[model samples]
Target: MSKRVNRVAEQMKKELGDIIFQKVKDPRIGFVTVTDVEVTGDLQNATIFISVLGDDSDKEASLKGLNTAKGFIRAEIGKRIRLRVTPEIEFAFDESIAYGSRIESLLTQVNNESKE
Candidate 1:
């Protein structure tokens, strides 16, 4: 990705996070954190990575709500950022945080076993 694309992606990530938390008032959208955003080279499409703090059902509900609110998000992005065209937004679950936590737990267990 070029510098322009990176900048745009960063801006999108920040603005989208703000919009989702502040603007959207859907009950289904529980605690959602915007992890990252990936934009196409042409800036036509964007994938928004998110982490939801809940169980499987909560994650599913949040994703469904986000997809339903994509249009509003895109419109807000266009209003906030001066781009020729607003990129279509897609929500994806980010499991990296959970994976890291699991790894940390395993490492701690190994260290404790060694001490014992």
Candidate 2:
């Protein structure tokens, strides 16, 4: 990605996080965090990665809520940022946090076993 695209993705990540928290009032979107954003080379589309702090059902609910509100979020982005055409946004669940937690737990278990 070019410097410009990278900047846009970062900016989108920040703004989307704020927008989801401050602007979006859906209860389904609880404890959501914007983990990362990936933009296409042409800036025609963006994939927003998110982590939801809850169980499987909560994560799915948040994803569904974000998808349902995609158009509104895109319009908000268009208003906040100057772009010829706002990149189409899609919300996706980011599993990195969960994976990291699992790794940490496994390491702790191994350490405990070694001590025993």
Candidate 3:
């Protein structure tokens, strides 16, 4: 069961990236990357973690655009994936990359301080 879920998640991650990149044309959605996806064990819902390359407002707008297009995206997924039930899609901004960058900068600052 767990393995199946993982596979689904992986497939979603790939398909979502392609869908968003090629299909979604909303100007609100700037440069974006589908980083990861988490599907519920029941296969009823999927939260797609995304990284947007822009300011906070751009991110917010992209999320809003995605939510607005949720139904269409789901329909597309159903058509492409052959799933008996297409999982509800949810967009989540991934912060781990930004967080890691911040941590690295902080560590560099500390190292510089130590040197001085």
Highest lDDT scorer: 1
lDDT of 3: 0.91
**Residues 50-106, model 1: lDDT tens digits:** 999999999999999998888888999999999999998889999999999999999
TM-score, each model? Answer: 0.97, 0.98, 0.96
Comparing 1 with 3 on TM-score, the higher-scoring candidate is 1
Better of 1 and 3 by lDDT: 1
Instruction: Point to the candidate with the largest TM-score.
Output: 2
Q: Model 2 segments beyond 4 Å from truth?
A: none
Candidate 1 local distance difference test against the native: 0.95
Q: Which parts of model 1 have CA positions greater than 4 angstroms off? A: none
Lowest summed lDDT over 10 consecutive residues: which window, candidate 2?
62-71
* lDDT (C-alpha, whole model) for all candidates: 0.95, 0.93, 0.91
The residue pairs found clashing in candidate 2 are: none
Candidate 1 residue 83 Cα shift, in angstroms, is 0.7
lDDT, candidate 3, residue 46? Answer: 94
